[model samples]
Target: MIGMAMRGEADIAIGPITRTAARLNVVDFLTPFQEEGIGFVMKKIDSPLLEQMFHVFRPISLVCWVAVVVSTVLTGIILTILAKLSPSAEHKEASLSRNLWIALSSILGQEDCPRPTFHQGYIILGFWWIFITLIMALYASSLAAFLTVPLPNAPLRNLEELASQTHYKPLVTQGTNLFHLFKSAKGGLHKRIWEMMSDMPKITVMDEAFSLVETGKYAFISDSSELRFELRNKCDELEIAQDSFLLTQLSFVVQKNFPFKDAFDHQ
Candidate 1:
């Protein structure tokens, strides 16, 4: 369409024509009718509640769990030894079962356990309390963050992430403006992403590209507007990435010397 306008073979080229630096040199564009950006379309993420529930324990390492258990048992033993060495009969006769119960209760957040009677017992309990406090604090903060945030199926939120992953094929139409934009991108993240896309197989049709994305093995990089429109009516399984890059203005294209260019711009 842009070629037709540039060659003066067509009076105007409408539809979703992107106004790019390359196109601007040959053809004049009217005021942008729609603002759009390039983004990825992929299957919607569905993280199971059961999986999330299991993730609660992920913050604490297996080693940490083992350490906590060993510490609890050792603290109980220390309390029992302290009680045996105490001058008071009640402290001297403290049973191992009672000492272990108190240690377990304190670690589990239960405050019903009796206070340590001896100074040595108090010191052991104080150290155990500090350990429990730190462990609980870390677990609570990690679990809260995991449960409150929505987990995405694909972790590719931006072009950099998309380029980094090897699981999904990130694609663009071979001869479209988007392909050219990426191809001509000078250096930096855009250039790296362009290389990644170039390595992957290209799909010629938009529908075909979207269909592949719906299967969850591919991510289609294209116009946000078209992707949203198709997602609303055709592909419920598909979702667009939240972050968009390479914003392009959609406008009508006309010959460089077209007489009514200003008129079109005014409207």
Candidate 2:
């Protein structure tokens, strides 16, 4: 499933039809240069799932309570443990007298002692925890990048030009299923100079939306509708047609033999 391209088991498709993404393999899909909006549809029903998840965040405030409890317990524990930390020799050399000396030192005298080695061990453990977390985070990030397919180049003009160009490479999204109209635009060429000209070279493909523009030097094309909407939202220099045949649309259709088109219609 992954790396089918590396394995050399991929298939390329050419059609005068709408192309779906070839998500599983590497190849060319000669698809119609049509524009369409995509959407997600689901049954409508009210449910408590969204609300229940919101309540899960309520316990996040417990971090403050945990901090207070841990700090207070740590303060008391450290003070009690300070007695044992005085010196091992103090236990055999003297008993409560050393305690009295410590109390006196705290009140008016002074006590000199080396730092605790356990604190150093705690610092070392913290660093070890941070290092493991960083490694795991880096591994997950790398895996995500590895699994992702790069965006395919959009052929601003037509399909064949985008697929064949090397120096003027066009980037397309991964698995761009193109149609047959792009691969076979030559059958009726004498009267269609504009369509023929669109098949010219130097149209390197890229998937980024903003890569095409600057009308004089660069020409961008998509489904006429998409081009219209994109220019409306994008820069002023991008132009569209007033009376061009390049305008198009996409419709859902079933095969002539597929009787389910009538029997299994959308509600």
Name the candidate that leads on lDDT: 1
Per-prediction TM-score: 0.72, 0.26
Question: lDDT of candidate 1?
Answer: 0.81
Each prediction's Cα lDDT score? 0.81, 0.36
Worst 10 residues of 2 by lDDT: 38-47
List candidate 2 segments past 4 Å from native. 1-179, 187-210, 214-216, 246-249, 253-259, 263-267
CA shift of 69, model 1, Å: 3.3
Residue-by-residue lDDT tens digits, candidate 1, 1-267: 888998889999989988878888999998998988888888766668997677767777889889989988888888887788887637433778888888899877787777787787888889889989998898888878877886665557887787788777778888999787778889987687787775666679888887788777888888988888878875446678889987879998899989998988888
Measured by TM-score, the strongest candidate is: 1
Q: Quote the positional error of residue 91 for candidate 1 in Å.
A: 9.7
Residue-level lDDT of model 2, residues 1-267, one tens digit each, is: 223422434322222224333331333222234545321111112236786566433333567446534543443344335535545323322333433333333322244611223443234334433544554455456546644753222323343332333333221223223223334446443124234344444433433433433323334334445455455644334434333333333433233233344453342
**Which ranges in model 1 have alpha carbons more than 4 Å from their true place?**
3-11, 44-51, 58-67, 87-98, 111-119, 130-153, 183-202, 228-243
